[model samples]
Target: MFLASSAKPIDESLQNLVVEIETQNPDLLVVAARQLRYSLQQTNIELTITEPRPFNVLEEFIIRAGIEFEPAPTPQELASLLGLDPVFVQSTIKNLQKLQTLAPKSPITVTEQGRLFYDKGAVPQPPYAVQIYAIADSLGETVNFQAEPLNEVVINLPSLTSILQLNESNNLISTFNLEQVQKNLQASGLGLHVPETGKIVTAFRSIGSTQTIWRKISLFLIFDSTTEKLTIHLRRGKQMLDSRSKWLDLLLSEGKISLDTLCKLPNESLNFEREAAKKYQNAETAARLEKIHQQALGNSQKKEVIQLRDREINQKFLEIINTAKQQIIIYATWLNHLNINPEFIAALEALAKRGVSIIISYGLEWEPENLLEIKEKLQAIKTPEDLPSVQLLGLEEDVYLQEIIIDREIYQCGFYHWRNSHESHIPLGELVYQVKKSQIIQEAYEILSTRCQNYAQKLWQQAVEKCDIQLARECLCIWGTLGKLETSLNQIQKNNWLELLPIYLNVVIHNLKSHNLADDSPILQSSLLLLSQVEAEAAFIEQLRLAYCQLLSAIAQQNPDTALNLLNNEVWAQFLRLHIAAETDSPTEFISQQTSQPKTKRKAAAPSTRNKKTKA
Candidate 1:
């Protein structure tokens, strides 16, 4: 929705949100919008909470024993008879006397209160003083009634008359009832100190209350990177409220706030973080290459092995599946007992949407009925193209091996049933060995399941052909030398050149920054040469390449006007801007260097935890 200024701005309420945005991501810029001030009637409530206080087993037993016997037994006699310590018995007697359940004299005799407590099954309802603050909105609705504290709901905003206010309902204050207060107190989790099943408000009376209090709601501008769109979000207490909030719905219905609006607004940039600045500064090309080469050698040489059991298997296995960016190969026996729950299905669906190749291979044939069901469920989530494949290897011999290979690197193998494991019950402890992928293991796996080997090889080939670097050595060799890059580009499709451009550009920029090389460095020159060649071939690629190249050049030469002009004109250049911003010391370092003018500050409201806001 379009933003407008509110008369009484709650600038102080937004400071904490500013600090959070600055800390988490400086990319987001906060702007002010008009706020909705609603009235809340604060009533000082006094109520008696009846809680069931049950007597301990020993206390009950002692009272029962005294009542059953003709003459009550003395502490010494009872202790001796029950084989209990005399001192312990004496202490219990003292406690019983304090409760007025037994006589305070020499003989341990049950009193009238004791007989009544025993008759009522040893559960006594104790009354408690409930001095609580309850809040109610102008809509005849009680606020913070659902397991939330009152201190967090009510905002102390002075001078409510200066801001625009919503009309208070005439019956809002008169609608207070004992039943409502009781339900609220129960839901609010008050009187937790009482050891009882119920925190029922037995009695409620009004001590005092305010006429009407106002709370200022704030607006937030959220940027969705995927969609490349900005949207407005409203704040409720410490949370950026969802669309389902009653307040938001009410405002939308009244036309106080629009559901959709696009407005370009002025905003301020946050200072760059010092810790992040140190990460990308003064990197040398040779040193970076050497490090990459070493890491490659180490990964191939060493295999980290971990043994997982019970819930650890679930955690580690899910982690591998969830973090998979390229491919996932699961080799198991069958899907007869596989749960195929919503969560597992959802994860697979998300991975499929991300274009991850999934290959599920079963050694033995799956039961026909179960196979058909699993196939139908999986087939429903498939994209137009045959993305994920589930198959059974026609094997006569019984196989016991199972493994999950993520990105053809991390390998987890054992007898643990990855799919058949129940979610409700923690799976039985089993030895599952997790190790880094190796050639020997890969060959052995392929031999056991040859049906999927060709498909896996084809996928790997396709990935490499797209210039998607899977190994550190490949990144170093291809980007390190211009000749190697030219040779690789010959194999990649012309249509995929746009995708390849970014990979090449990133490598070039990374080398430039790490080596702290000049603009004319061989890596930079080679990248520019490739860009020129691609631009000469494809007109569309040329346009994108030019925008990015110009942005890069502007950043290097400290030309803020040129960079800003490109950013304003080209939406595609946003990524390039973000890349340069991340690499530089300050996110706005380029703009600040060329243009000395500061942006106009805009007052806006956003959400933040009260605790965090206070600290900020």
Candidate 2:
């Protein structure tokens, strides 16, 4: 792991803190760990960040574990903790916190899982590696065991005893994807489970390649439930001709062994013995990784192409765009904070200096919004020739490339935006790959870009064809269809149109009130004419004025105190007074006559009940 962002001497104060932590009390460690100056800065990792800042994790662990005990014991305080490197111990404990395996508290506690592993043993005791050895032929040669990737064991026994030993391992635990030794099994599929341990022991052999007929090897893997581990033994048949080799010779020479069986056998096989089986792995495993070993040929090598993620892609785009010597074509629906990033601007400026043409087609309705940026950039150029021509390609529809492509060569695609870099979190990326200079790739490039350009030209043509008359006619038809123009405040409020878009409705009302509803344009004429029609409808006008009087009466009858305050308004008093009746034969008097009539509404309730409820 690369440590520190740059090569520099460690700060002496931070170094002192590290020294103090080695033999310091909890209080001193907590104080040292919280120093922001040297906390994460203590160690800046460059790659494979297994744990977030080891320095920070160490400090956090100390604080969390030592908080209850103001001055906890040093690493030396615990028994059996002798002769250990203080720094490595701290680092190891910090790294061991996967799924609560270890908790860093005063008297650091090992969780149940950690205890189980320690109980069995560590390193060699837990069986990180296994070995095996066995015979192969009947040429009366000494048995030898050798496998390329797997270790060899020492077992020199006769065919009868060796076969019996192999049969004893009947555990058929499970299979790895396409990695099973072989499909061969006893007819009954019985005798596969070990009787004493009740564990599955799978035994299989690897048939050598046709080039080496006597290289077949045998192997077995046993799983123990309680320990939760895997121990495998691979044994190669001795190279010398012997009884085992003769048995294999009989199987292959007689044309009894299938070519597929021989061909599928790995040339470099692993031979493990029964002795090294630690049996940590249980019978059931939640996750089994499928092992696929492949050797690629031709141009499909991984090193030829690399994927960029997050900040890497952002930095790469800056690098790629600066290299444009001929032309730059950018298609995007949004512009991120590209202009604000000085590196991006500088690189773009350098590219422009090389007389490279930059064509950007932003596929959004508000296309002109970004045109200001181009104009601003051009203004910055001292010489007209040095200024890159920024042409905005008008697109008919949203036919835009997902990636911000440059010169149809290099491209960066992801959710990241040069625009949103100011935000706290950056949107992650999917992939960024350049096209190869092959016929298939170039053809694909031309087809996709041309399709986008063709659709863009069609859209621009439609926009240019839209004459003033056509636009005005469209506005007239649309307004006439909607007919949602307000005649008064009541209609506006009742429809809740104000909350939906109070600004537009308020503008229309304000224009009418100020006599600014001019008809110089078709849109204004359509709106003004709508209001004229509303005013001409006299029945609607009366209902509009009477609405206030009815509202006042309802409020007054329901809540007299609220109505009293509302009556204070001169206009409201006028409307309310108009509702009062004084014996007369006029139409207004007949309408007001109802004010003197008796009301006849009653609540349905039981007379005997003090408190009663009724259903609607």
Candidate 3:
């Protein structure tokens, strides 16, 4: 028996010591008379018994008597409160003082030796860390209680008799608290409700060189209302573990326990081992399929390469010509390399003779030295009699790259001049791929073919136009002056000369107005002579004046209305005075000077006309 304070009644002190002893070793018992005699000797003093037995019977007697004892009450109130009691309390204080004198004068602190003795004899050790379980019964009613190591105890006792007996008899039991049990279960990751059915179950594994190992365990707890009791099952494993009828009802209402304890119960099923083996086999099969796909892609890319040198290209040209069946599209910036090889021409002639269409597309700005050589080579090939066509198309100077797509299947080498010369060669190989008919590919081919034909035709027409312009410029230079052509224009017949006369007169007028020719020069005199020789009707003369006025309005460096008025007056006076002077030999020079003066003044005043004419 042990007591907390000397201030407590003698009987209560005796009962507290007895209760404390019986809690650990509950079978012990003590006589009532002997407990009374020991308590009466100590008024307000603590007493503890080192050896006591039959603790249960002593606990029962103490509970029936209703003795009261208080704890240390935060340790500070102990001495003052105990001193207020008369009689044996004073004697107990004196005894403590005498014991302290015999020991060291330092404060009375319990050493480790004293603490060990106190713990061994004074306190009841709990059997285990008590856990509370809240479970639902078959009727859906919930029950919660604490399990002490092995014993399960209800939360509340009905009377003191039961409390004293249980406290004295059990070393491993404690009262239950539901709130504490809920906190523990939440920490353990066993959620309160079961999850929905058919969710994808996840399992984790760590792969090694020779084998794999399962790393963590998880499962979706599935509940069925028809079963009337909850059962434990594995989602990644196999069969459900059957429930113990008593424990199943207890766990559902109570909540959780150690997983080890649940597994040790009598009725868990053994089929879950088989399910794990099946999952491992499936993982091994997936690894093998990825290896086969990589090998096929590697072989396809190794077949094609590029040929860079002209000599290698010429060598391959024979092979290309032999293989071509339909149309050949050769796109190159330089025609110099092809002109140097005679076999290339013979092969092309052979292909054309076989009735294949040959189209060679190359750049237009060929240097003169290169052009002479190219022309010479081309003249040597006789036109094949049986071939449907052979055409040479020139691309604009801005275009780059030299590619030849033969029969739309073989893509031959691109030229890199420094790396591969005619004397030293490198054969970068041809790329060949089969064309498959699909909507996207068909549309792309149609667009590219139309664009290529249109581009080629536009370049050919421009080249012809440029040649004609160059020839006309040379003829003008050979004739010594444009004025001589104007003099020859008068000899032509009137009806045959109408269009050419107006054009020649406007050219002379533009040159004189721009000061390119002096107003009294031979070109002006010849133009006037040509106009004079024409059989001039009044309506014809008026129409010519109006046409001249409109042309002046278009090119004049002044406002169009002002320029038109001046031009109309000047042209009409010039025409009328020319005929009048020819018939009457009298000149109307003042009228010409008056009309021409207004145009000169207007042109001088408006500087913006220069910018407007430049834009035009």
lDDT of each prediction vs. the true structure? 0.49, 0.34, 0.34
Superposed model 2: Cα runs more than 4 Å off:
1-304, 337-340, 366-375, 378-388, 394-396, 399-401, 404-408, 414-427, 437-444, 455-616
What does the lDDT read for residue 439 in candidate 2? 40
- Model 1 C-alpha RMSD vs. true structure (Å) is 30.0
Candidates 1 and 3 compared: the better one by lDDT is: 1
Q: What order do candidates take by TM-score, descending?
A: 1, 2, 3
Task: For each candidate, give its TM-score against the true structure.
Answer: 0.30, 0.24, 0.23
- Whose TM-score is higher: candidate 1's or candidate 2's? 1
What clash count does candidate 3 reach? 25
Error of 3 at 85 (Å): 99
Please give, for residues 225-333, the per-residue lDDT of candidate 1 as tens digits: 2112344566655586554244544554576653333112322211121122222221221243244334445654464555668778767877788887655667666
> Compared with the true structure, what per-residue lDDT tens digits does model 2 show for residues 294-343?
11123356432345666676666677777765555665554432333456
Scored against the true structure, residue 238 in model 1 reaches a CA lDDT of: 55
By summed lDDT, the worst window of 10 consecutive residues in model 2 runs over 34-43
- Each prediction's Cα RMSD? 30.0, 36.0, 48.0
